[model samples]
Target: MKTFTYRTATDTAGGLEPGAAFLAGGTNLVDLMKLGVATPDVLVDVTRLGLDEVTSLEGGGLRIGAGVRNSDLAAHPAVRRDFPVLSQGLLAGASGQLRNMATTGGNLLQRTRCRYFMDATKPCNKHAPGTGCPARQGDHRNLAILGGSEHCIATHPSDMAVALVALDAVVNTSQRSLPVSDLYRLPGDDPSRDTILDHGELITSVDLPALAMPSTYRKVRDRASYAFAVSSIAAAAKVADGRVTDVRLAFGAVAPKPWRALIAEEALRGKPATRESFLAAADAELAAAEPLKDNAFKIPLVRNLVASVLEGLTS
Candidate 1:
């Protein structure tokens, strides 16, 4: 690891200095530092910045503080009742010990779990741009199938962020507020930066809009738990008289960002809530998928998962 200055943040302004990185849970950041992937000169601890409360919004929604722990957020009565997808996604992520420590903001800021990116000795375009993406022809079974560029094929590793994107959550930062859907940037020619968040910008809170539709989260991994997703789905659907009134879907572990299946949502909006409809909708969205050699199975895997989840919701 690198020697760096550490200080508790007094305010957001103090946390925004050059070459500074926020330390909330340090569950992900500390590991990267140890691996020599991240070496910020200043580690700004913002755990005591009074950003740990979960407040009810004036408009019947909820605003989750960035410092709020994943365990707390998942256990909140309001979250479990209103947004079960978020709660389920949180529970499906990391182990219990890590969930107790991982914060909302830090969870959203997690780097790709690609071995090449995490292994400093390897030549990963995500870690060192213009080098090369070894995972392209290597062990890329868990890498992205959608939104991946020739430069990189890393997958975003957050289940919570996928659920948030499906639920239309808004991330409030020191710079500006934007939908979680727009926060991530696709790896085009440059893969060094994962998010569109400006350097030193502090994420204060995330706002969840009141969604009336029923939603759920599903993660497919190598094991039942404690494993990163191979592919995951966050789905919300509203059915009336056996017809799909509305729907929202977000895919994880298949893209550089939590991919909102707008095409699928559009396809299912006024269609029947049946397994066939679900499959057709999924196909519509995946028509644009450009799966790599080792991960071509992701196309069928994601399609079947989407169909099954929507089938359950409608049934």
Candidate 2:
């Protein structure tokens, strides 16, 4: 580990120096630093900038501060009642200790847990652009299946992001507010950049629109607990008179960013809420998936998960 200077920031703009990283929960940043994947000359502590509140918006939406802990957000009455998918997604993630320490913004910015990306000696394009991505032909059983390019196939590891995508959440940054869908970018030629955030831009809060429909989050992993998702679905649906009125589906652990199943949703809208309809919709979305050698199972996994999630939500 490198020796570094640490300071708490009272304001967002003036404190960010070159080679400085903002610290909130230190769950992901500290782990990356210990692995020598991230080295910072200065650490700016933003945990005490009064960004921890979860406020209710005027139109039954939610304005969750960046500093709010995962466990608190999951257990909040409004979240549990209105957006159960978000709550369930939070609970489905890391262990209780990590949930207590992980913050909303920190979770949003968490990196992929790809072995090549974490190991300093490996040829990872995400770690060092133009070096090459060994995961393309290596042990990538848990990597991305969709929205990946030749440069990188690493998957985003946030369960909360999957749910937020389904809920149509907006990420509020210091500079601007944008849809969560726009917050992440596919690693085209530059695998080093995970999100669209600039050097000094900071996330301040996340805003979720009103969601009053049946929703759930289901994750399939190698283990039952304290494990990242091998495949997961966050789904929200509304069925009226045996026909699907509205539907939203987003997948995790299968794409560079949260894979919103917009194609599937379009197939399901105005269709009868049945197993056949769900399966067809799932097929439409998974048709675009380009799974690698070790991760071909993710194709079927995503298909079944999307169908099952929709079935459960409509039931």
Q: Count the backbone clashes (under 3 Å) in each candidate.
A: 0, 0
Question: Please, what are the lDDT tens digits per residue for candidate 2 over residues 1-315?
Answer: 887999898975533779999999999999999999999999999899889999999889999999999999999999999999999999999999999999999999999999999998898999977889988778889998899999999999999999999999999988889999999999999989999998778899999999978899999999988899999999999999999999999999999999999999999999999999999999999999899889999888888888888888888
> If scored against the real structure, what TM-score would every candidate get?
0.98, 0.98
Query: Per-residue lDDT for 134-224 in model 1, tens only?
Result: 9978999899889999999899999999999999999999889999998999999989999898888899999999989899999999999
For candidate 1, the lDDT comes to 0.93
Backbone-clash count (model 1): 0
Worst 10-residue lDDT window, candidate 2: 8-17
* Candidate 1 regions with alpha-carbon error over 4 angstroms: none
What would you estimate as the lDDT of candidate 2? 0.93
Stretches of model 2 off by over 4 angstroms after superposition = none
